[model samples]
Target: MTDEPRRRGAARTDELLRVTLETAAEVGYAGLNVEAVARRAGVGKHTIYRRWPTMAALLLDALSRVWTTDLDYHDTGDIRADLREQFLRSAPALAAPPIGPVYRAVIAEAQADEALRATLHDRFLRTVEESTLARIKRAQEAGELVSGVDLTFPAEVLCGTLYYRHLLSTRAVDETAVDALLDMFMAAYGT
Candidate 1:
């Protein structure tokens, strides 16, 4: 009812983001084009440009939406069990065909672009850190974690391992790896 142009503009921007992710996965980040995204999204080229000025900016926006952040970690009063649970939850997305490539591309891009780095930090890295912080804080209060153990360090160690393994090795995160990691964390943190 109020300002139909603005409403359609917002809808077009959303559509463009969705289509850009699809195209990036299919064609790779280097191959992304504004025209292709516009055609696929059924939005005009001007609409996309108005929303995102550059290709990299548009891709960053697309990656932000594509990576799901709806996950919430649980505290079972056991750190080891919680790590295993997070591992299982992440495995599926790690195994996703589009997710792996998109994550790799974003990581590679972040090295060269400051804005892209910020996008990754806000969209992906911060979310993981926040979830881990909550879980670790719970473990500490429950006395399941070791005394004087830095909570953030363990989360970084484990999640960093998974990220590198996924990006470089291109390997599917498996239950065995999860169990082995949990075993180490349990040995260090179990009280």
Candidate 2:
């Protein structure tokens, strides 16, 4: 509750997230357990268990926290440009070193764990969909984009393709690819 305790809590949470990322990347999804993360993070087993109720929950948090990409933005008045900017900035984070492996492992784990998959969809993918849909609707109302454009398509294409490439492609997801993907999506629906 106090400042010092809060600070320590925040720092410890950060450490736990980092250790999970490293451990997940190194040992992979099935191999990742809280005890190892606790030992690596130099925290007690209770620290992780207290914060996250389950192993799937902890890994989901680690993936969400450690492999972060804050795609938030103030509307720039041009919907296409805003979307492009978001992709350009956040796409690179996907291809970055430790985050990529952490992401891959979380996704892999999610495949086997129904609960983890649902949590990830709720936490990450749903938020993205809602945000993009809202922005696209705003753009439509503002006359920045054409009406009746189903916002879902663009959001799905942008995020889905990025993940598709990240998980499958031998080539890295880069700035140019992000720009191209945005362009392709925009061209389909933009006024």
Candidate 3:
């Protein structure tokens, strides 16, 4: 039989993750209190501490739930169309206020916490890079990226453009920006 303590621990951890994310959504990272999470989860504060031991640990796990793994890469024969579709899929989450602030907070926290940084890098950031890179490489192989262009750079440009547009520009990242960015990337980089 499985160990009783380990099974209970796992259940408690899952409950905490649910409560933590819900609380994070209701209150931004600055207001994400451990006591609040414990109360929401219906678990004791010591139980949370016994599991995560730190707020950052709990926060990172909560952020991980933000990504929709169901929305993986879609490899249409047309690379530009595929990339556009991927961007469209991501846009809803980007459009969410809770997602934007939560992601920003997690990114800031990751910058300082080595362990959290690794978790974010491995779980979220790396997955995005890998998915995007796969699409870029497919585009290149299909002769969409011009022979002289640096494939990786175009992928970076795509992500960088959208991120900056959302994070800095006063203009909203609507369909116009998405279509424009895709057109620019495809025209300049497409073979």
Q: Give TM per candidate.
A: 0.84, 0.84, 0.79
**Per-candidate total of colliding backbone pairs:** 0, 0, 1
- All candidates in order of lDDT, best leading: 2, 1, 3
Model 3: per-residue lDDT, tens digit, 90-138? 8767557556767766666667779877887787666676778777887
**Which portions of model 2 miss their true places by more than 4 Å?**
1-8
Off by over 4 Å in 3: 1-11, 69-71, 108-119
In order, candidate lDDTs are 0.76, 0.77, 0.74
Q: Single out the weakest 10-residue window by summed lDDT for candidate 2.
A: 1-10
In candidate 2 the C-alpha lDDT for residue 31 amounts to 90
40-153: candidate 1 lDDT, tens digit per residue: 876678888888888888887776666673557777666777778887887777557557677677677678989878877886777787787778778888787776777788
* TM-score, cand. 3 vs. native: 0.79
Cα lDDT, model 1, residue 129 = 78
Displacement of the residue 31 alpha carbon in candidate 1, Å: 1.9
